[model samples]
Target: MKTKISTLLLLPFFALLMLTSCQQEVVDITPPADSEALSASSPLTALMSSASKMDGSKDNIIDNASCLSIELPVTVVVNGLEIIIDSEEDYKVIEAIFNEFEEDDDYLEIIFPITIITAEHDDIVINNADELKEFVDECKGENENDDDIECIDFKYPISFSVYDVNFQVIDVITVENDRQLYKFLKRVKNSEFLASLNFPVTMVLADGTEVVVNNNEELENTINEAKDACDEDDDNDYGDDDFTKERLDEYLQICPWVVHEFKRNNQDNTVEYQSYALNFKEDGVVRMRARNGDILTGTWSTRVTKRGALLKLEFDTLADFTLEWIVYDIEYGKIKLYEEGGNRIIMKKNCDVVIDITKERIENYLQECLWRVARLQVDDVHNEKDYIGTPLKFFANNVVKIRLNGEFVTGEYEIGVRNSGFFLQIFLQDRPNLKLEWLITFLEPGLIKLENENNRMVLRRHCADGDDDINYIDDVLLTWEWEVALYQDGDVNKTEEFFMYTIDFLENGWIKVTDPNNGIIDGNWLAYRHEGLHLGLHFGIEAPFDDLNHRWKIAEITQSRIELKDLNANGEIERILVLEKKE
Candidate 1:
């Protein structure tokens, strides 16, 4: 359905209402104790309030204000060139113009009458530079400590339950964004009404890790622990160029970084250094491994100056990567290094990358865990969907098996050394798309990237041997028979397609379906977690169940009911399926 099902959300209310038109029983929950309830003046409440404040430092190149942000689609003049700044990516254009010539003076003029969002999440209009400076003057001076917290944030759509003096539920207010949460917390701070936050709230840390807190105490602790855990990038620079020397050095030494992009003196050299890995060791020693198993030694050092962090590499043979580059962007598991002469390198960290690949190492990693076909493109056609719910297992003696419909399909695989590189060959009958001698381009402990002439594939390792969550799901699904309670596809109701159908989930990953006419159909089913939990189903070309052959996200699950949703590219629900246990 195109219509989105919004979470139960309510605007902040000023007055409590008495039941008059309808009689609905309100569950009586005791009012939170003074210490348990969110108090306006309490430290935890203050932290939450600060965390909800608008972070305006991301576009500091345009506003130069740490506590204020200029709304997008604003036009600005950069050195006599007028450009429409629509998104954050356009900020790099401005930075590039400013850094074009060091001898020339840089300037930026805003075509004003723009809206600015304050740290308090208030929208203000500024007509000229003078009017904008009024708010800019109030911001912290270039990365100085401020009242707003930026290292952790509350995952939105969280809600609070409003209560009356007698502790009876009066209303439930849902907050959809930071602005709404900030305004609502102000009421909580002023003691305008009695309210308590709903339990089991989720918070996201700066590094994109999610933490779920079930109670007030856990929430408080989670916030406190993550409040100061990351670099907020509060400076006026566009990216994280203000890293300390020690921090930058330690970060590089954590894992081996593979070059994803490379440019030297305005010439692209990505193909030559595509998979070249760099390992920064102690005592100024760095090792570089080439695709042909050649190891090159280099000296590396870092120094932080008033301008920014600089990384210098000295290699006798690898001259292209031997320049002193400015560290412009430091993100999780990635680093962006650039220099003035159009030299740049983008490296991504991979702790499991095998620098010295051998026949033994390749076979060991293949047999370690089950491999899921995460991506496959053959002859410009996407083919990964056909392999859903099927994971390949590698065994000893060149034996391979793919689980399909809870049964093992025999196959043969071989790892061979070629003049170009290591190649993986698969011989599976009736699977012509996967029967190519694919060159292994990238290899890591949990990942393998393979490429043929016009085909590419990625396999991600999946080890669920002892995962308690998967085990629990498997047990719950096998306990009883289930029937489709609802099936919605877009604006169409397709529940009757599987009328009187009974589904039995077997332990070996097969689903046994009995239709209304007593005809039996077998399908494959797998429960796994990637970003979130999902139920992968593959019914082949079965008449009615063919429409249900896709990986559905597990939205909710209980002992008797399971809710699954298929989301589109924008995360909107495209289809929903609900299965309830047979009574």
Candidate 2:
């Protein structure tokens, strides 16, 4: 008796949907006994409905967002049984699909195996006889590196009957014995469909002679010789590699290797190598491709040293290239070159291991590009681009830097893990009680989206023509009295005795105004937010000085000038104050 195994994914509208959006409702519907056209409107409505629940305030961007993201696990229903993908075989299939998506294609069609039942209902035609061994082998976990390391065999072989454009039965093949099973698995590469076991069952290979053999590895070894004969020339570039001299030779062969990442002298010099290439020939010659198309040739060789293997390159054009480094075990995805005194880089291979999406990763993702307010609705009012340039930046050591008006303001951030995954918890140093929590719903290349309990934010990587050189602002603000370019209403003139007080903004949200007059007035200051950021102070501070007590909105902060405004309920300005740095 042959078991029918087949399934068709009918997610018609959710093209890029994944596990993160599992809340996407699937309309209740049984598999059609005959056939019925399904509509996409139901699922789309559910998705839109789910989005409406978030707070519509985009201006409330605080540390309350998460960088957590999850991928969809393999799931498909077969022969009335739901199968959750838990083994490497399933992961391989999913990985194959992802790789295929990068290539140009109109649609994806997968080969399926099944048993065809006749209209008479009494008879079943089975066509998986030739495909059974491969399925059983895969279920036993072949070439598996991680979780699915155990061997498991199903009680019986499963297959699906092929269907044509008109849904007409095309073919069915079944395996009655071991010899046919061997032939099926041997020619698996040529076959369009690789077998995926439908129902979950566990056993050793021996169901007596019908079963190929007993014990998992023995069965795999018995058929591998035949499988290897067909796969000699077709293997993944890195799959067959072991960390040996031969592997290193293969890695450095003919192609121009671009230094994708770099570090030197306690500083990241990756920008120096972006447009250059380092080509190491087998004959000991290394050719360097300069940014201006100048060919700066160098000699390179690998030698055994007391530290380990050493990668030595000598280039006359660039003295920095003439250095030696001990080869640490190459990992973190790319070929890692490490030297003494904290210098190393992960080369061309796109292999950067991120365990928990660390602060550094977020900094790299955000700092590389400036992000503008894509959608900002605060108190049911949309916030236009009142600010300019890349306004926000995430830095290491749990810090967040933001540019308001022309000055740089910074705060703190943290990530927490719960039952599902990770979440973001953010609050400014000054406003500790105003904490924000957000579930990190999605992240991808060039885009990061955050949805809070009350707000939804979408920040596109800004591609404007400006360099990220906010360091100069830091230099000017290092120590300055808030004076010089003073503005009251529309007055862009100087203020008196602003120099008597040495102005200071502490990272912990403390603003100390100390002068001989009333001794000192300590106030809580908050910055780096979208909505009203306040400085709490109501003491001997006077008129123009009383302006500091209002709920202030940052207009611009730069190295030389600072602009602030008193905000009313509807975002109308009540007053404006400008101050220049006292050098």
Candidate 3:
């Protein structure tokens, strides 16, 4: 019954292609020897090397390709699976459209294959003309239903010809600058008129000499001449690899290093993500082990930038280390990285722990951050609403502080084993006999679950500073639950059944009263300062609940208790009512 809901914090993948404008130089096909993965003679390599301002992202290619113009008898990799593309009409139509490349025509009128994903997470692959028609028909109908696109992963390294605004062939784009070519393709997807090209796309030789090709024939000749240079590109980074999990396990002689230092904005924060480690296998798989033994799997690769800087780690997806980090140095058991946002992290050997696994992990996790009780469960029934405003904290000295109800209760705790299982024993100063033994059920950086046989409590790491920043009036009221502890009209005592009814203030000048006898009653309530020393509430409701409908003056207010006096227009007290915030 103990469940933890985690909200993913994803670092967005983004990049900008920087362009440099200059006059054409003499052909220098002397293999720039720029990137480790790309050959020197590749035209893409030469053009990319010419960029004066290079960013971390455009330094490589990351894209979702849906459109492609595959050459007949060419091999295409779709989701890491390679297949041969024969002479097909749709491919031919796209090829013909490029053949008649006219810049002023406003658009290329491209009809390439779109990656169709069904609602059940299956791909719709069309092999022939009939299948293509069927797929399109199904797609048109799918618009009305939930069956839609999972993603549009474009067929990368698609042999496509680049044309300028004049409809004249500019260059043949291939896998050499696959990263830049991918960006251009993404831009073309949302584009209605691509008359103005975005990529500083000029075909060139290895020596930065611009290649001028007026027609598709010339561009083809140019690319063919650079074939040997282009062949050296590593398609592994292109996500077209045959490496499986078993293969990677057999391949890695050692795991990636652990993060020993984390600095944001140039400040050292080695203690933030305590006990962080990463395992980047040779097969491009990345695994992260961080606070409280939570393991996250992602993809990482190393590529040489055109500027000839240090080889940087390129990550696909992660919560913390989100962008391309420059590897300052990486050795057998140590690695240093610099993120684009001026944040840096260092890693060393990740060794095994000697303490009790659950205890040590949970203690370290708690010390690194503040937590709040999001839910409490007893016998599988959730009682989260009762402790709505409480926040918790754990220090390194085996001490814990819980802001319960309206008081801060400091407690002592111990991490030990009992009956072949792990237990967290919390001894509150006020309640010594009532031992709160919580079984260590679940633990993560931002979430944790502790359960006994019948009780479970789910705590969440605070995303921002605790709601303590909220001022007392409306903001504080919205954060906490106020309940009627006692109600009276100077003669009758209604405090006995106070648990059966509750009053909650609403933002829209309304009040919702939960009644055990009835169901729910909607009324109006307002609280404001009448005089410098007097706080007033205008409470109004219908029939049986009519006694609470009176202009009341607040005599005192505290974290747990509130005192109000029923008063007439003359400001004379008739009766007193008391309320307390639920713990």
Candidate 4:
């Protein structure tokens, strides 16, 4: 399953205030003769001459010629609402204010103050009888009551038929420079339907300012205009035709709640997750399903704004299992998506495991016996038959003892079929250099015969020599052999014999030996081999030396020592030597 998550964020509201003020200036007034004004018959001329005469007077004039500047507190109402105005000139100035109210009904309205002229100056000349009568009637009607009156009320219901309603064509305008466009759009009260749109919408103003409508309409307009004007050569290019709304309905059809599968190597574990919604409600609710038919229902919540129906989402993976959520803004033919956090899905496969086994634990089911020996001490007396039974007793205290420490010493043992073979590795602790030997008896060799013996303290395999057919043990062949050496007078050259032995079980269990030809040979012969050979060595008073004849005679066989060599041979030997009874 493929899953995609989404979220939405709301834009902030903008506030606007309109401030207006007025100033009054005084001027000298002069009066004109009544006969002269009557002959001229111009009401404006007669009024102006009368205003000039009263200009310097401290008393207020009452003639029709004087222009009285009256400061009246005026109020205009719209749709049963009223806003106060101070003077007639202020009211007239406000009369030019025209605005379009965005609504289903779409209407245009203007509100302003009303002004009236009354009789006042010394250039008093009511020249025309009709004009005098008209002025008198107006003054009477206006002064009839002190209460304010509604004068100009022209309602023009707007027709949206002039503008094309295309969801994919958006008009983008910058809020910073084009403040009038911002104010006009902000006044639109019926914009709730904008939340459901999935395409860019353009808004064109009377002042030729175009803006794209979305969740972040102001931001989108500003950014788009900035980007467009960055490389523009013409300064009059602030138009809406340049921007086209890119439809996103097709993309939004693929909802966020989709399923995905994840697998790991070297393991039988798999994970599946699904995303449910792109524009989630603040209540944190969503619907999801896994690939294994598992259904999960939850909520996604974020603080992002929705300009053109774009929302953002965020998830608490630790608290839940999801990663991150991001909301995109669709405006002015462009989609701006914001990425918030890191991706959380991961798969791990194929790993190696290691296990460690201690020496004490291996000795429990494997160790047979242990022994230690010091330098032999004998008295130089030929008639000492009592010395035979009184052999020097070696204390067992100095003997190296093998004790079990850990758990099982068993491991998976495998060998290929045919002449094929397998091997086991054993690691041992180091000890002071001493004459040691070992042997191994496989309880079950399965199909192959086991020929094992302790060759050298450090076990290794041998490659076939120049004569490959001479039965030379190949490195791949698992074979075991052993050898021994005796030292006299503690010196290698103290006049003694050295012997080396190789166990050849296939040839009749005959031990091949190499004797030292040097007259004063006393070097210790070391033999290392695998631990599968069950061989033992006898090391006691085996013979008496014939000093005159220079040949040793067999007197009596003493104690026989036996030990099991290392199985895996990893720099350590198994302490399985056995003590034998003297004959």
lDDT of 1 at 223: 85
Whole-model Cα lDDT of every candidate shown, in order: 0.84, 0.41, 0.46, 0.24
* Candidate 3 runs further than 4 Å off: 1-241, 244-361, 419-421, 429-436, 466-583
Q: Which candidate has the highest TM-score of all?
A: 1
Error of 2 at 195 (Å): 21
* Model 1, span 238-275: residue lDDT tens: 87778888889999999999999998998889988898
Q: Scored by Cα lDDT, where does model 1 land?
A: 0.84
Weakest 10 consecutive residues, lDDT, candidate 4? 154-163
What ranking emerges by lDDT with the best candidate at the front?
A: 1, 3, 2, 4
TM-score of 1: 0.62
- Model 1 RMSD, rounded to 1 decimal: 11.8
Model 1, which residues run further than 4 Å from truth? 1-240, 243-247, 264-276, 283-285, 288-308, 314-322
lDDT of 2: 0.41
lDDT of 4 at 410: 22
Q: What is the C-alpha RMSD of each candidate to the true structure, in Å?
A: 11.8, 24.7, 21.4, 38.9
TM of each candidate vs. truth = 0.62, 0.24, 0.31, 0.14
Q: Model 4 misses residue 314 by how many Å?
A: 7.1
True lDDT of residue 184, candidate 4:
24
Residue ranges of candidate 4 with Cα displaced over 4 Å:
1-271, 274-283, 305-324, 328-341, 344-583
